[model samples]
Target: MRAAGRGGPVTRAAVLSAALAIVDRDGVEGLSMRRLAEAVGRDPMVIYRHVPNKAAVLDGVAEIVFAQLSVDVKDSDWTAQLRVIARDFRALALEHPHVVALLVTRPLATPLGQRPPAVVRPLEDILTLLTQAGFSGETALHIYRALFGFLYGHILNELQEVVERPEETDEVLRLGLHRLPVNEFPLLRELAPLLAHYDGAAELERGLDILLNGLAATL
Candidate 1:
């Protein structure tokens, strides 16, 4: 659906929002100026008036995603605040599974200085958290890399767990992992039951424990 207020002025927010929904229903490749125009009941030129090109639309989409993350680290325990933001990111990725790929891939193409303000806001907030916690500028940058890298990797890994049948009880059966020959994949076969019952939040928390604990000692 187009933004609820698309009937009014041709707002940039509406255009970006419609693009996000398009990306949600159809992957980013499916989003085009013409398609966005159709989604918002406007001409292609009209859509262009709001966003110069598809790349800008995507940048806006990224901003929309990163904006969901809490950057407010002031007057709170650092670890706890980071955990909240990490969990928020995990939820956002799951909600927009298709867009998650763009989240990582887009940054490689866009330079740091040229990135959208909304995209940079979270990093600045993290820097605030790290510096306030006694980390030097260089150390804070390293910590940001370590923390965000793990968070991104975790989201990818978690999403790769294919639940072929949600109602199914058997792990191997649920994921269709039983097709492998028992002799070659013996351990994996044996662990099927345990694997099927994977809890992403619990697993992420365990990883956070190790990562945050190790980082804390550096201060």
Candidate 2:
């Protein structure tokens, strides 16, 4: 019943998936080796065989989250590829808001090169896309950083705006926008109807067009 580094790679993957399920349902805080084992029907001690520690579990969860992003760079031009990747990434983050928090913050805790391969692959793909499209090594990294930074920022902003908000009401008062001082925030107050129907994907597309076009024109 105890897994002491005994599970093979497939077993480890299954354990990681179970860990992800726990994160989706209960958030990262609710994920413990014991909890993972319980979710996967293993002894609490057994999960450690698959994952060395809590840190590894978190990293594995991050790896699993990253793996969900499927970007097809081969089928399109650089701009189109990037658009697909950007939209796919934002969609995945929205799908798993709790796991996305881990995805966004884990880089602070672990170095990029030292991260798991799955976790690092998306960056590598982007860098490849840029290099193939004529960006030099240094320029590619810079562009990747700028692009990913905006993507990450957009994901966080979207989560904050949409995650905890109540179901749409016909009126803005239900969104608590009515609480703001009308004089101090006249435009935002007046735009409540538009804000009530926030479309993150559309805004992200518009912003990306600006960012990517600006990059193209600049470089």
Candidate 2 lDDT over 1-219, as tens digits, reads: 222233433378888887888788888999888878777776777677778998888888888889887656464487788888898888888778888878888756987678988888887888888887888988888887888899988888877874224664644564676677888888877777777677898989988999899888898
Q: What alpha-carbon RMSD in Å does predicted model 2 have with respect to the real structure?
A: 3.7
Model 2 regions more than 4 Å off: 1-10, 71-76, 162-171
Cα shift from native, residue 151, model 1 (Å): 1.0
lDDT of 1 at 89: 90
| Winning model by TM-score | 1
Relative to the true structure, candidate 1 has a C-alpha RMSD (angstroms) of 2.4
lDDT measured at residue 72 in model 1 versus the true structure, 0 to 100:
72
- TM-score computed on alpha carbons, candidate 1: 0.88
- CA error at residue 108 for candidate 2, angstroms: 2.6
